[model samples]
Target chain A: MTDTRMATDAAATWHARLDSPDMDWEDFGRWLDADPSHRAAYDAIAVLDAEIGERAAAIAALLPANDDEVAVPASDAGVPDAGSASRGTRWRWAAIGTSGALAAGLALLLVAPSNDGAAQVYATGRSETRSVTLDDGSRMQIDRGSRVSVTGGGTPVIEIAQGAASFAVRHDPSRVLMVRAGGYEVRDVGTRFDVVSARGRVAITVAQGMVSVVPSGGAIGDATMLNAGQSLTITPDKQIAIRGRIDPARVADWTDGRLDYDGAPLTLVAADISRYADSPLVVDPSAADLRFSGVLTIGDGSRLVDQLRAVLPIRARRVAGVVHLDAAGPR
Target chain B: MLAANRHQLVRFFTGRTGSVAEAEDVVQEIWLHVGQPPKADGVTGEPGAGPIANPLAYLHRVGMNIVLDRVRANGRRQRRDAGYVDATTSTVGAEAIDDAPSAFDAVADKERMARLTTALTGPPEGAMRVFRRHRIDGASHAEIAAEFGISRSAVEKHIAVALRHLRKALDD
Candidate 1:
């Protein structure tokens, strides 16, 4: 073989080896020190790998055991095989495992500031506003009755399990910011986006810059890069596709004292308000299809009840932070 | 109209009878009755009937009964109305709904807009833009709100002043 061909073969071999969970650290370090471009390439590959694992965990949330077949299609060469763990257990894979753990750890990332040193949880009762400062200097607001677990694992990772949660991510490309729930996984290299999980689907709306949601895993095969005004939805089965533009203001309105809905389902509004309310907004048989527009002020119960009574003709009253809505007067 | 307005009826019925699907079923019944409206029963009255009071209110009450009867036939007061208003609208509007929609879009709510306008009195006109950029647009107000923890009054004040100024500017 020609000298150039010999060198090319060797480089490809090395590149493949580094991606394996068991690649030699000494050899990898020597390579990284050998060339700056080599280090950059490695960093890119590592970030990409971490993202893939994260996507899997996100997809895992929505997929039933039956869906495991079609979700990680047998034809997909890019997706990790469901049987990957059987190959070998390597500590180097710890980084990958940590990324996976972060993805898994993410479901528990909600609650006060203590789940993880870097995690910040913002919770609100019905009609109450909750704000939090993340370790990365970003801020998050958890709308009434909702709990979000935040962690700064591979990047500043966070997961919203239920209700409504808003993220104001600090710009840090070096640290990826992610939010996971149901079938939705939002990864921002460093952008602002709001992720809401309700019903069985997760909706990701980009407010600024760009963000990417690939069917819970990072691959060009299933990824859709979203820009400002763009949005994506992850179906109940881990399927994701570029949806359309959503109102950026409404996406992050919980913190701003406005719960903006353009004919949203009462179930969704209930989910959003459930976070702030001490008592959940029960979308009853009478209230489920009700679509409310304009801002539903959330701060205290009596006021919320009064507001519901005044604006929409629904009766609502707060017990603790839980504001119950009913057709009957201020129950 | 049943499909198109099924959702609107859900919202309207949601306001009145507090049943989204009952409102929806009423819409279904209304569609059956008025779908071909011989221009008699559907008109409610004549054109000169003049801005009828509580037309929607009366319809909402009618729809509620229909839904209740349907539910009562099966016999249940569901803790959760999982079947009301099919998610067709939610799924369709999911991507299109604006959270921080452009201020320039035609907002249909005049009273709320007036309230937003009235709230702008305390801050300078630029304050609303800042409010839009930081709060509405989701910018961290650390630099704009001028503190790590922004106080409620400061935010209200910024908006109030901006609205007041806008109201004045528009008046001229």
Candidate 2:
């Protein structure tokens, strides 16, 4: 095969493999880095897959109709969040245990986690919010567009694969509740802490008691102690920044529809807004660094944009699907 | 003019809001607003009260303004259901809601949907079944292969063929 043909075929195979839970990321990374063409081909395939997934229902409707409702496989081992998988598909998975290998793969992919013990996955959809009490007596408030897998039989562990979650743990020294996000892990030494993993940044805020932030991959030395009224933000590039003396009560104020930004970058604010609303809010590179301080009540997503326009010397316009914020022209 | 281009307007709103339901609501609100008198206490049936020199442009401008107002006025306050709580238990969930794509994204998505519909017809029936079961039905490859009485590798190959064909069609 020609090099281009080979790359395309390899990309297709990679796409199929990655969709399975058994994919070895280390091997995939090596293959991705091996050739530049591979990366391009992979990107193309990924985009296509995402597009197809988004419109799967609509396209499927147009195809030759098959009324056979796939039955859900008998076991609940692979069920992540029942709400996440449409009821029809869940039943199909539950009923389709004809092949043990496929049933195992379905469980792994749907409940995608690396837990030593049995894990239960919790997920919130675009605008959905769910609060669940763990078997260990800990309460977790899940953020929108977020998923966290909880493994509780021995030591309680939370693996936040995406979005943010606020944890209010009942102080138990005998069984530590651990939160793993990105490359860092927050071990609760009996405390209430908010762990936000969004936009390539993980910020851990200690509302009460104390917690230790340790690098999961050992990229850094020692567990950093974060006490009450303190916050630690780790950027994707592994740069650690610490903030002291933040109001402990204000930690997770978003639960009350209030976003308190004390001199926060506009880009960060935009990222937060993008989480709640669909419109892509773009701050011009020139205005991206502008800092804002105050309380913005997020009602409808657009009002926040209006509030920003009122407070700062910026022009906000909704063009097509994008909300563009630019430095206002000199009067 | 707005009535003439109702479908187009709905598409425009859908692109703006990233939701067909919201788009329909916006269009309905716009229709109501257009029928209402511009000023309260004015005659609802008065001649030329609702007429515009450039009806198309006027319809679009009014439609967009209403959407903006609706967005500004809308506030989503999530009531806390009795599930879990601590000292800091609040009524609202600390999360973003209804993350919609911008107009550009909606347009692109529409284009992709059209392309996907066309490309989906290219693969053979067995390959299409594999792709559909895995993608739409959310079945595992092993399950799909078993259902079709095919080997695991063959199932993967069928899916790869379907994906490659679709990806190629998209690139072109």
Candidate 3:
């Protein structure tokens, strides 16, 4: 259908659907099965819905101003606070499992470290990511599926539990920037780069300056001196090692509302999107050999699968909130 | 909506536009865009569609887009205008404006916003239920209450009460 015609039809259907008192599984199923173009239409409208949600009030002056243009989007995850860690998940978009447990809204502060401070929690939610400005005028991208409650916002002692995250440790002579993911603690003198934690391992890449990551005190995770264009892999038992440079932009794509990679392993890409996505993106174990390098929008992860299908015989289906991606029948 | 009836609508486009006439023109543009549908998705309105359950809301949104588009379309002119804004203001009342396209780019960071919305949404459980019932589920107050096992009045109270909290949290 023409874009205009499609938009009209989709909007009408959506309006009717959204207005209905009861929108059940059968209804949604019927709508989906009714046409191949159904989801395409829905996604188009979803963009508009996103537009409405963001600029509702600003547009309200044309409406009643006091009208319901103030309607908000859904919380990004199962729990409102959970989605707070990342972008929120609406009911319609809740077709994913294991959304990132995000906290709500931004908290900008010039955090100064207290000498006796304990770990304070800073978190982002599913489909949500955050960058906090430190007192040293430095910043860090808090990745999805993780929470690091540092003692002081200045010291920036965050623990990475699962998923990939990055930090641009502010350069400060007095402060040692440290991040703990599993057993490995990334200690830095001053540096900028990316960090990903998964399968009981954390990979740290230094993009600028240098860092010395030993364990918390004299305890060491195989201490390494990482400068620009270098990386380190820290295992669960605090085993640390070194490597070469990675594409910081591609790894840090989530910070910019994008999921991008260069010849990225499908399994690894799935793990990446799986962090910010409300839905879990599972790749076929058989197709683990496949490599994907492209951009996927932060919201509506099915769009990523759609992009993936353009090149490979992969299909994604949602069942009980799980989005399973497997090789399509035949090739 | 008629021009005479659009006291609120005009104000909506005012911030987007520099003048009352431009705002009115945007209102006219809204009429064309709204009565039919959007180019992208057409006319996906909600049940109550709330305050925006009319043509005017669509108009305002269109107006805003128009203004942004105008800004983009006039980038070169605006840069020149910025240089002469002081002179123009002293002469013909130009707006004291800093042309910033990057501010829009700043909106792209999901992390900072993610941290923000968590607080605005008030820990999810509190407001999400109401938001879903009211917007996504299209459920009535009675239906929502039945689902939640609260009275209809309780559901209404929930929405009413939730709005107060959201307003406070969002600080709007």
Candidate 4:
């Protein structure tokens, strides 16, 4: 076989194992490294595979059903005429048992760490939520498009770098959990609260117990103590801090696919919607300060803007990939 | 885990892009996607969220997807540039000004779909059926093998044959 043909065959074999649990990525990496031609061949095959996947529904509509299967005789058994020529090479792509491979791979990665405490970063993709439990039995339900990192040693510190996260900390008198976001810090001891830090703003809503929110570089005495049903937001400019009341049950409602807001700024709502949006949802300056109060169900995250438009006098326009929301003209 | 395997991931990307700087950029992009937190916390309870079965494989898949998106974007840009030049050179002022990039993309997409349809018929006799079943219909190799009364390997071979044929046709 020619070198190109050989590489194509190898690429095909690799493509078949793309989703297999036992996929040996190390070997695949080596194959790509071995020859530049191999990478080119594999790229062609991978891109073709993705294209086919994208147009699968359209292609399915174009093709006819495989009714010929019923016409073949039982005595001919499983041999296809087109496959007969390559019968000798059939063993090359034989199916292997896949059970337990996924479990084994997960096991290798989830090994419990030592008390030395190395930081681990956890993040969620668009419209994807993740729940992580800390060593001290604290649970965190991370919202989509959010990033949180935790370091467990003597004192546990949780940082919400972007997006929103809800924390339910287990009571530990010896350890005070420190949660930080947008240059502000929250100290918690056996409490549940939600923190949203995005677009240069940090908002924390207390659902249960009490937590102290401290400004960046502020002493503990300067911390604002928030009780249950209380919410505080530090604006993007850090010039104004807003404290409001919220129903404790409404905290982190996105976990149930519903965003419950009680008079939230349009800018803050836009920032929350941007997590599920394929593109950034920017509010026009005219609509930025509008207060919105409603429950928006985030089903697949497609109709969020439409839902917002129905409730408020806002018009959303797509220019390129960004969604710009402006106040609608009088209708 | 991403931090621990950074070097290997960079090497893997470098092999594909054939440039260390490009590979480093890709790895950095991945890091930004994954989000890096400054501090750490202790963890001990069961994973309350859906667990990714294999994160390394997941990361590799994500890397390949990023590469594919970049390649597709480059292709679209090149096509759009060529189309823009054609419109400006062949048409008068008003007509040329009316031809937007979005319209050009629509026309290019239609042409590409036509080419794909033409290439669909280039595969071997039985290969098309297997490919359609596995790729379009979302059937597993084992399921296709059972339906055809053939071994799973036969199903894979048929798919490979179809892909090879389609690649050749489309490349031309």
**lDDT, model 1, position B52:** 23
**What is the DockQ (computed on Cα atoms) for candidate 1?**
0.01
lDDT of each structure?
A: 0.45, 0.60, 0.47, 0.66
B1-172, model 4: which lDDT tens digit per residue?
Answer: 5777789888888887777898887776554333232322221111111244555665565465556555654554575567642332223312222233355656876777777766664436577667766776667766677888876556666777677778877778
- How do the predictions measure up, each by TM-score? 0.36, 0.40, 0.38, 0.49
Report per-candidate DockQ: 0.01, 0.08, 0.02, 0.15
Q: Write down the TM-score for model 1.
A: 0.36
* Per-prediction tally of clashes: 55, 19, 42, 10
Candidate whose DockQ is highest? 4
Model 2, range B47-68, lDDT digits (tens) per residue? 1222233343334444544443
How far residue A113's Cα lies from its native spot in candidate 2, in Å, is 18
Q: Pick the candidate with the highest lDDT.
A: 4
**lDDT of candidate 4 over A114-200, digit per residue (tens):** 222246678888778899887656888988878887764324677788888898976532234678888888877567899988777
Residues A1-331, candidate 1: write the lDDT tens digits: 5533333223323322322334333343344344445433333332222222333333233323431111211121121211122134333433342432222222111111111223444555655657777655577777655667766433356768776666666643223456777755666644567777765557777787666554555442234566666666655665544377667766677667766777766665666555454455665666665776767866653355456556665666566665566566443
What is the descending DockQ order?
A: 4, 2, 3, 1
Error of 2 at B171 (Å): 68
Scored by TM-score, the top model is 4
lDDT of 1 at A289: 57
Q: Model 2 over residues A140-246: C-alpha lDDT tens digits?
A: 88887788877643246788887778888764333346898877888774478888876667888888876767787552225566667888878757676555556
